[model samples]
Target: MKSIDVLLAVLANGWVVSAVLWKDSISRNTTDILRKRYRDEKTQKFSTVFNSRKPSLTSNPASKPFYITLPLDHFTTSNTDTFQSRYYVQDSYYQPGGPVIFHDIGESSIERYAPGLVDEEEFTVSMAKRFNGLLILFEHRFYGESAPLTEVSRALGDASKEGLTAFFKYLTIEQALEDVVVFANNFTYDFQSYPSQKLTPEYTPWVYVGVSYSGARGAWLAKRNPGLFKATLASSAPVELKVDFWEYFVAIEANLAASGNTNCSADLAAAAAWLSQAWETQNETLVDKLIDTVYQADWENYISQFRNQDDPRIWDTRRDYMQDAAWTAFADFQYYGVQGGTLGKFCDIMETAYSDNAPAEGLFATESLDRAVAGYTKAVAAINPYSYSRSARNKAKLKQKRQSSKLDSSLDDYAWLWQVCSEFGAFQVANTSRPQNMLPSFINVAAQIDQCIGTFGESDQVSLAGPNVSPINQKYLGWNIELSNTLWTNGEFDPWRALSIDSTTEDAPTNDTSTTEIPQCGTTFPRGTQLRYVIVDGYHGSEFSEDVVENADDIGLNPTNTIGGISASRRVTLTSTGTGTPVADARNAQSLWFNAMSTWLPCGTQVFTFTSPQPSSSTPFKTRSSYSTDGPSTDGSTTEGLTTDGSTTSNPSRQSSSPSENKTQSAASLVLPPLMNLFMLSLFAFLTGVGFIL
Candidate 1:
């Protein structure tokens, strides 16, 4: 049954695009999932309906891209003084007195795709409309077209080299944060001198939004400069960076176990044990022999089959860097969980193949195992988010030099790897002590350290296992750091969630002032920084994706995808109520996010509304749903309605009191159309047909 679900999801969704883009893959930032996924599925064309509502800033008449001059070395005045940094502004929602939302682009290329926070009519845009706020998207310093160095002659060498090392020094997260600040200062209030004269030149409240790595930046921005950002909405931000991230596998195993697939878990564990034993032997020949024998294929050929590049093994040691590819495949499935348990599907296959009484043609069979391994390898290889290949890095560099580039996206993979090697040691290594360990011991902390040494030279200050890691922890406040008005969220199943702060974590910065204890998922932590764990079944960044209703086939989702541990903040599809209110189904993440947004920026009417009529009050107040209100149903649907003030409205209010004298009853409620019911029903049917029933 699990295998069937997996097949259906893969067939329906084509591939886990976001998982391939941002999740654990070979070379984390190598692929740009957004571009590749869209190319395969939606082609280069975006949703025309969506494009009409929130056009790209570059395409909009009221919007334009701007390049601001920034210091190459922000700290040293003697160094090269300036480099051009890129940013975009959309003034369609700008109101002289309104707020602004600053969207932080992640480590990927932003200009390659159109930008909008929430979908066509979702929460972010809805809030923009409600507050009449301006929306701005800023590309990080080294990503997209924001290139400090136009060309690089060398791929690997000393820091004094005029290529990678010289350019990478300016690509720090702190510099990127400053780039946004400079852009904000120039655009937000410097109106007379700025490109957009239509916008006001006054201080306005600003909100920050980011996902994954950028999400952590947003929180850090709010933390370090609280007055700059009014509030931040961060989804799946691993603010705490750890060097030896064995907990990554721990999360994977726990999530797999949550699926209730005992046999699947057992088989996968057996495979892990076998692989670990091979690594423990420390014999390259023995390891290669075991791999070829078990899977009935040569390790080098199978690993290189996808990328078409030679094996990633270092010439100095026979250790195959591509050995992590199989583990990555399993890890991605657990992290993605797109159609509810992608990992479960892989496990089911393993269980079948490793069964004691398996047939001759099964995975254990010499001939069949070879075929199965090769097929799986090919599928895993196709998971790239970026258009170019690792083999094309040099080609891209040479091409950049030959052309007048508006935006050099070739720096993405190189820049991201530099960040990981320099600061954030988020290496996904194995913890063999765990009972459910699935990754080989060779993919250990030392291997990753060696990788950094190979990429960034031996003299590089990147030894987290050695004496150099303490400064990074001290500078970032490690896991114990605290900040106010920032929400830190992580998916319960996300392998990266292990690095994030949670209830059981004891590494929180000692300087944290908040008294709130981080709670397990589905609970509230009101004392300190806002922390949310999406425990109700989701993969990495699932909360950040737009919550729109689509056909099961379109999204590779089935009705059964909602089955998992229940949490207060879980999203589930509810049965339609025949009424055309378009409020039957709602996303718990969106609901919670909007609710938090209202609290942070409370100057306007709440973004959404849902409430029961006052108990026969003498002053009859009009009961009208707000523009963003999509109330939960009383018929036991999964949708949770929002109150007038952005509070979760699950059950209708039973408060017994007279209506407030200040409240005005809506005229629409007082004089209803004769065919109101029919009109609503028709509207609902129309919305359902057009896939807008969120």
Candidate 2:
């Protein structure tokens, strides 16, 4: 599934990159599940057939890109510097007085496929149409053409430290969020081609929607600037920022075992143990054997060339680099979960594709670890998971990435890395704390910091102490936060779930509502009441890929592609009215999302009315068939905590009334309607799709 997804992405990108481009494809950005998973590095060769099929960004003039000048620093008066930040408007479904639904293209270039995201059938686009609102996709600062300092190279070893610092100094979540508000304050659009639903918070209502990191921003924005946004729908928002973040492996290990990709978790664990032993003990003979077995490269010759060329191992040169390379198959799980688990493809090979040298059976003088290594070696050789080979182009590109000092994205990476080095201390280190860990024990936060310091001028300053995630968490209130008029969702099997409200590995514990904790979050939501949901078997941002449910077979989804051979995509096709199917559960959740929004959104009339609809304490699945609401009212404030605020309660227990649904109103299940054609065309554009391949 990983390779196929990669192939589709590569095909969608319309350019066959030199084989080495995959190195650039693996992003070590803040949101590991979104960026490297869906979109990757760009090239102009290797693949030309698919390029012809890609839709042009100009195909829809209504969604054509737009830009506005934004101050480099909104929090400080340090400089009056400004940059042109790019945005796109898909107002086909918008009315003159409708609300504007802003989608933050968080940390990626919207210039790719974002400008073409005008299709009425898109999940976000569909929401805009449903609410008669304008859909705006705003690119985050320091990404795409939104960079404040363009000509300034952002390379880690930037020639001018001032240039590197100056370029990234202004990029903070606070500043980016401010950019949205600032843009809205003086917002104007001349859609001679289309009527602008242009108005500020004083006269118009605004809504925020995003997935992954952008989703976190939605939650934060709703909390900080309600005057600017009335409602927020955050999907897979990892509000908690932890430096260790070993729970990442916890979720991955748990999910792999649960979904019937049997032996995958255990096999990888054994492999990690052996890899750690061989690398750390300086077992040269074993290292050579493993390298020859896994990568099929001549270890001695490769080493000679590596020394001569001074190539940068994409992850790090310190430990066995393949330790990082081993999991590329699984990193894109969220990206492929809509189709099926990305691990599904890799596991099939792991379970079946044995290389010639792989042992036919357990042999004498060998422990079980030997068989595990053989299996892994065979799997890696068969999968060619990294797209890395000892070709001249591959080695050359590796050297090129290291020697190049431009931070402005020769491959467009350093921007996100800056954020990771800034406030998002989500270092995906090995969980040595756990009794059973899946990653090589050698990978630690210190190594990460060393690289950051070695590359950029400074680390997050955490050395061995790990990053002080408190800076972002304390400010945002982490999972301790509660927002009225906001909806939160997560994928049950997503590795990122470890970082979300559904987390259970200690850092922060939740006394859930299904059991009776008061406000149910993450696990369950009451109809017409609570706004949190955990999609059973769902992956990161799976909500946006709703179209996959309708076209499962058309796109070659097999029934056995998911857990225990249960096609995950098939679960989305189960009737949309019940909790039995993954799709059904998600749609039903979205139904509540609609019901809540209908009552919350005061565009014109009361669509569905609801009372102070408090969900039962804990993760209880209570259902209410009917609801009623009074029309939305305005306090008439022009700034912070705007009119039509739907936030009903906070954790500290703020008293705000919520609406009730007259009936269980479900959002219309999505239909592709030629949308996939456009979706694939712009598939290369969701720049930051999943998280780090590292």
Q: Report lDDT per candidate.
A: 0.44, 0.49
lDDT tens digits, residue span 593-635, model 1: 4445555554221121212122221111112222112221212
User: Residue by residue across 1-694, what tens digits does model 2's lDDT show?
Assistant: 4543454444322221211122222322222322222222251101101111123223473334566777776644545677777677765666776787887768666654453354443566657756778778787887755664344543322234355655666676777777787777767766555655446666677778888788888888777665467667887888887544556666566666676543565556666666666655655455455565554432333354343333333113224335434554554454444224345545555555344332323221133555556656655554343332222123323334343112233323556655665556665656544545656655544445444443345322212222334546766778766666677778776666777666665655565432111122122234333356777767666666543233322221121121212234433345432211234445534444444455445633212111221222211112211111122112211111111122221111011111001111112122222112332233222211221121
**After superposing candidate 1, which stretches have Cα over 4 Å from the reference?**
1-64, 115-127, 153-163, 188-202, 279-318, 321-324, 338-342, 354-409, 463-469, 503-535, 548-586, 602-694
TM-score leader: 2
Q: What is the lDDT of residue 419 in candidate 2?
A: 62
RMSD to the native, candidate 2?
16.3
CA error at residue 436 for candidate 2, angstroms: 2.8
Q: Over the full model, what C-alpha lDDT does candidate 1 score relative to the true structure?
A: 0.44
